[model samples]
Target: MRRGALRPFRSFLPGPRSMFYTTDGPHGLPHNPFMAVMVPRPIGWISSVDAAGNRNLAPFSVFNGMPCDPPVVFFGPSGQHKEGGPKDSLRNIEETGEFVCNIATWETREAMNASSALVARDVDEFELSGLTPLPSTLVKPARVAESPVHFECVHLQTVHLPSKLAGVSALVIGQVVGIHIDEGILTDGIVDMKKFRPIARLGSSDYTVVDTIFSMIRPG
Candidate 1:
């Protein structure tokens, strides 16, 4: 087989006619396909601390890295909290201006999902998730000890987007101030991501593991 070539499956079924719908109205599917269509999104396992040092942890699928020169990252919080305020991760970052992005992996997948539960403002999700919190080098928010990689970031700014609900959605951006990488995931001083096996998010109670990897150099 040629590299980067697609192989046909015996049981493959051809999809029907493409269905299109406007955002103004429903698509008529039982569940929204927007998130599903955006497959294998990086899971932002964010950790932050409040003014009073109340730590918070949460997972958001709407997250990704942006602009490598400055090393920036962003995550989206779609709705208001259950108690009618910003979610703990957003609220804490707003208060402290610091957060840590812990890489979620198959090893800690269950604990990552557990931390996403709606909890009180005073709740410590690290404790709730049964994950050990290690003091960060440049931030007050603790890092997930088991995670192979961590990005300690300082909140740059937050942009509020219009939401259908009473409150607005938040797009939180951060500048990476510090980074940690486990040497075990490195090969010849380069990141061997297959060994890292970061877990990614999908729609409707689904998740994917990034164990398979390939690389291509850009044309000069």
Candidate 2:
């Protein structure tokens, strides 16, 4: 291609290199460099209502859903503390037993990150984070208008894990009630990641974009 400009190393480069490890240590490797270098994590902009009917929002990367009979999704919240306050999203979901998962995109990355702040329970993350709260047709909680996809869900169960030497962790499972997708993102009756440009979390303070895509067809 471009005249002798160090032809991008072909076979010399390894194929998508990564190192996987688990954290079972005290404090789980304080400030894990894993996420930052991991580069991009899918964000679950969770919305929930407190027992008092107050709303809360927060982002978590330990999130994914399964296509079981009723469609179930789950998220993990670390029992970490900042200024000795409870996580607003986890607390609200525990209190209200309901939440909405909104898929974050590049357009809404800043707003999603804002909701990650350690705000008071009563503080409305939508307002504080300057994110638009769109009413959910099938769920009590509202969805983030800036998000490209939204899944209205009801809490099914929570698996509490022992903290041992560190704070506790919780696995929250939610049953999907409704799904919503942006019209612009739907092309040829399919949602494209390139158009979605979904954002993901990396360990620490790093993040990544998700437009790069490829496909492989498995033998039927």
Candidate 3:
């Protein structure tokens, strides 16, 4: 296939009439299709420690690398937790101003899901998820031992998104001060996706693995 080619899948069943609704109102569907359409989002397996030395780990699907220079990344935590407050990972980063973004992979999918459980602030998610905590060189928050890649970041700022609801969503931006990559995943000094097999978040409870890959050179 050519680069950026569109491939439409035709269905024999009658499709629903196209409808539009403002985000402020209900989507008018059984389930919101917004997230569903934005598929294969990279999972930010964030780990952080609070001021009181409590460790927290959680996965945020709204995460991505901001830019290459200075190495920046961000993760958005939407809505309120069951405890009626920001998530532990967000709260800890707010307090300590440090975090580790561990890459999630197919091998650690179960542990990654386990870490997302809503637990008390004092609970150690590393232990709960049965994942080893690897000490970070520059950050207080430990990296997931099972993860092939880790980015030690310093909190830059948190941008709060406008919300009509009582609770607010925030984008936590961080400058990656250090990076760790497992040599095993590198082929000829380049990171190999086939070996890494990183997992991504889909809509609802679904997830996807990087099983297939293709490359294209940018047009001059």
lDDT of 2 by residue, 36-155 (tens): 655555678899887877788888898888998889989888865554545766777777778999998888888888888876566899999898889998777889888889999988
Give, for candidate 1, the lowest lDDT window spanning 10 residues.
9-18
User: Each model's TM-score, in the order given?
Assistant: 0.90, 0.81, 0.90
* Candidate 3, superposed: residue stretches over 4 Å from native: 1-16
lDDT of 3 by residue, 42-151 (tens): 99999999998778899989999977789999999877767788878778899999999999999999999999887877789999999999999998999999999999
Put down candidate 1 lDDT per residue, 1-220, tens digits, no spaces: 9997989677644567768789879899977799888988999899998899988899989999986887999999877778887777888888889999999999999999999998777789999999999999999999999999999999999999877766559899999999999999999999887788999988889999987888889979
List pairs with backbone clashes in candidate 1. Answer: none
Q: Candidate 1, which segments miss by more than 4 Å at Cα? A: 1-16
> Cα RMSD to native, each candidate?
3.6, 5.6, 3.8
Give stretches of model 2 more than 4 Å off.
Answer: 1-40, 80-86, 164-167
Ordered by lDDT, highest first, the candidates read 3, 1, 2
From the highest TM-score down, the ranking of the candidates is: 1, 3, 2
> What is candidate 1's TM-score against the reference?
0.90
Q: Once model 1 is optimally superposed onto the true structure by TM-score, how far is the C-alpha of residue 3 displaced, in angstroms?
A: 12
Error of 1 at 147 (Å): 0.5
